[model samples]
Target chain A: MASSIRDELLKVLIEHQPHFLSGEEISRRVGCSRAAIWKHIEELRHEGYEIEAKPRNGYRLVYRPDRVAPEELAPHLQTKRFGRHIRYEYSTPSTQTLAHQWAREGAPEGAVVIAEEQVQGKGRMGRTWHSPPQTGVWMSLILRPPISLAEASQLTLLASVGVQQGIKRVTGLPIQIKWPNDLLIHGKKVCGILTELRGEQDQIHYMIIGIGINVNTTSEHWPEELKKIATSLAIESGGHLHRATLIAAILKELEEVYQEYLNSGFRVIKSKWEQAAGMLGKTITARTPQGLITGVAERLNESGALLIRTDQGVIPVYSADIDWKEI
Target chain B: MASSIRDELLKVLIEHQPHFLSGEEISRRVGCSRAAIWKHIEELRHEGYEIEAKPRNGYRLVYRPDRVAPEELAPHLQTKRFGRHIRYEYSTPSTQTLAHQWAREGAPEGAVVIAEEQVQGKGRMGRTWHSPPQTGVWMSLILRPPISLAEASQLTLLASVGVQQGIKRVTGLPIQIKWPNDLLIHGKKVCGILTELRGEQDQIHYMIIGIGINVNTTSEHWPEELKKIATSLAIESGGHLHRATLIAAILKELEEVYQEYLNSGFRVIKSKWEQAAGMLGKTITARTPQGLITGVAERLNESGALLIRTDQGVIPVYSADIDWKEI
Candidate 1:
């Protein structure tokens, strides 16, 4: 359904939250078929909305919009602090831009900036992410990890494990992680992570981790070219999912993983990321700024660098685009 | 005299700039002594103000505010691009803050942000720089150097050399450099360079070089404690100096040095910074976040890291605070 129609449907449902509304009345109000209204209610159920239904009386709201506020998720946030201070906007240019300003203004660590729609959602390498409204989850988290400039890259590896585990736990989907940190399902990308930081020679002042996940976005949200590579959770699972619940689950995992990293070092994250990426002994090409090197993915060294064994020797890749080579 | 009095005196001189005003009349208009008026005029002359003095007349203005505008200095900026798009403010919180916003908004490389006074100027390690009005060069330069994250520290070393040479050429002051770039004169700090960058894991998006110089400030500008460590050009040179001339000279040298870095690597900057800082073979203590290690300063390695020869072995220091040992 169109976002405006869906919003109007939601408004009509909310207006009659105190009493039940008949199916014909709701269908007329929403300008849709009764079967379409039933489908919309199912989608809303998938989105964490509890709509109680009866055979004759009609459907009544189990939770009102004011009671279960989706915009303010702090009370429902289960973690210690990750999403405790979250700001939700209906539309924005980019959440990363606002996160930078907020981080500089001394926002606490674990603060999140989320938006329903992004006109110019940013991607890696100065690219743009395709972000639609009321479907995917787009957010930027403020983090102040006690790490040096050289060790900042490890956080990217750690975040992928947290997010992958969270997705798997929430929807029971078989989410996999690629090299560095790209979440995938069935050989298609489902999420992107953009990590940016402002730092001196040795210390990182703060790091903003921008995450865009295709939670309930459908095929119509992506362009033709992106459809070949990008997939959403709803498309993969054939059912819609709740964005706030998924966000809360990811923050909980991320908080634990981050604390584990600070307490026990990257040892746990290293093992988890290595298992999740599953590129050991595979032939791949790393396209780095220095140049391209086709080699076998040997193993990750102590500092979380991908040490690739090439024809000449083992070259460690810091940051690059990994391409699979079929022989 | 106060800044208000100086501005009022300049206005009075400009009101009768077509002719000349008598000393008594000028002094009466400014509400100051004739001797004080003569001292202020001499100070103005030293500040690159072309004041024509006659026998019976007081003084005639040669450069009106609009005739020689100080804010839009594109004409005076000699480099191909550096400082070509300059924004001069009478007062601001911090030039670095503004430069970041402009850089993100697609400000071209070599764009400069200069201010007369900074109420909350920034310093390295989260300290505040003392920036006074009309007597210091407080500016931030936007740069898009083709470099990696590991090599970004070389820009700081390169900038110190440019600024040091510019000071020498403009005022003939014997300026020296400390490690990582701190400008000193007579064993006291005279200037500071805070190099901040925004980058990914391997590629740098842009770097902002914030330079603060105590150009012609008097001893009264510093607080009771800052007087022990901070000194200015006027205090050491026993004369006032022009702010814009010194700024242009620095920008010229910096542009050249930055170009050399992009063309010839860090070869020129390495030797120049080594000779300027004069830390080789000196017994010093490096206070690093890992721990404090007292060793002899050996040499700068290929990646621009300082190799310190300790009793145990040779350790490379990327960033640290160096304390000298007299023995």
Candidate 2:
């Protein structure tokens, strides 16, 4: 496959880092023709990777971009097929849109769509997501789960847990998950998960889980509009972050979590999410389309719907915009 | 809109009753050009209606084919927009598949996809539906309801009720809705409803409800395999039934039930469904992926999940294949 060749070429480039490797040497090392090596080098350059080639000295690794490439990131990722089938776009309207289209066209499960920037990214409640170029992880994962639409919400919770674990593993940052789908770092939003599904009656054709993580962004990276509430992993960790490594970790963790979810149901992931949840046992105001409901965030039910202990009763909040009061 | 022309033409044709008007006459009556009339008539022909045209006698009605078409049935339809926006296909793999595609491409609410035949029609549990040409109603409706996926099952129940009402209205035959999503006549399945949804997190994007009804099919018309279990409207009514009229009634009833469901919760519709449900208070065996659940079919919950009162407990069945026992 072209991807395998690309991966092999990337490995040789990383191994011979900071050195100029002659085209003949690269061909011999990678077991390919010199012309093939040249073609791959040109392709890498087109993918926004920086490589310098001299007439006699051959190719030099000038700079490796932070964008996620299967070749550049495959060595770090441990998942079997979750991130194996990926569509990397420099710019897209929304990863979710592309993922949805791919799923409808019979793209395999675990296929991913990642973008350097999203011109029309979306969050929950039809809100616009701010995805600056090369600043955040704007990706969507395609899943074909044999579950009812009611039970599909469990995937959102599973993704939240995976994201929390991935952030912790990659950057050693202490992150917490807000009940529902927000991932928070030091009490500010760092990531959000949006799960979409296509199904008929009992059969789920496919599902697209879109995740947006503010990885390498700073307060200045965000518009003045979102600086107050939004936070990035780089800002929270006080350093520059590797987007490729983080993406690989996230996909690896998601594969494991998704496997556990399918095998054992949501009980295991639900407990993990509850432990990482920041707003459990806290009073919150939720704005639903019907009306506003004030209640204590109790816990997630077996089907992954949020159970809110309200004055009226234990209302199962299918969807709502929750605002937690500072305690 | 072009749909308005199709609707007006349908009204005139239905009023004429087994008679055909020339293209010039229809164009003059509809205040459009003869070319426009020819175009609309061609559109109707594509939807599976058989129209006969001559040089001197002009156009004569050869046969009103058994199919679902806006032009052939729209005059009889009373819905506002449910059946107004229709995509009629001669053959599709499945209406649900096409409806999902249309929904993703920004198809309006109440839009419909009707096919003369489904090459690969499907039922619950991967069962193949028998959709013979012009002998059944294989249609899918696009609905943009403001409800969670958990509540989407309610649409199936509402659709069952609608189908039951529609059949009764047109054929004056008493039909019973089998607990989850089937319409039965004399304990034989005459219709099935499959409800699907597209959503992100808690917000639902669109819901596609596919309905298959055996219309104008006699015992000889059915395959030998389905002769004992499936009965058509014609077989039940002891005469050939007009497919377009029945489709119009179904769409009208579906529109009404959908509107009522949106305005109100599933409480009222659930009660009506319970009254017409054949398996209510009867011993039944339901086969689910988890295991077999045997109990007396008690009622339907708010979310339209079937409530079965077993000796062990009252279990809520999201989806299952049911078999009723003899009283």
Strongest candidate by DockQ = 2
Off by over 4 Å in 2: A1-6, A12-63, B1-67, B89-93, B125-127, B307-315
lDDT of 1 by residue, B262-288 (tens): 888888889988888756788889988
- RMSD to the true structure for each prediction, in A, is 10.2, 5.2
Q: Report clashes for each candidate as comma-separated counts.
A: 0, 1
True contacts kept of each: 0.31, 0.63
Task: Spell out the clash pairs found in candidate 1.
Answer: none
TM-score of 1: 0.72
lDDT per residue as tens, model 2, A192-271? 99888877666688988899999888777778879988999888888888798899999999999999988998789999
| Model 2: share of true interface contacts reproduced | 0.63
List interface RMSDs for the candidates, in order.
3.2, 2.0
For model 1, residues A31-80, the per-residue Cα lDDT tens digits are: 88899888878877777778999889898877633221233344346788
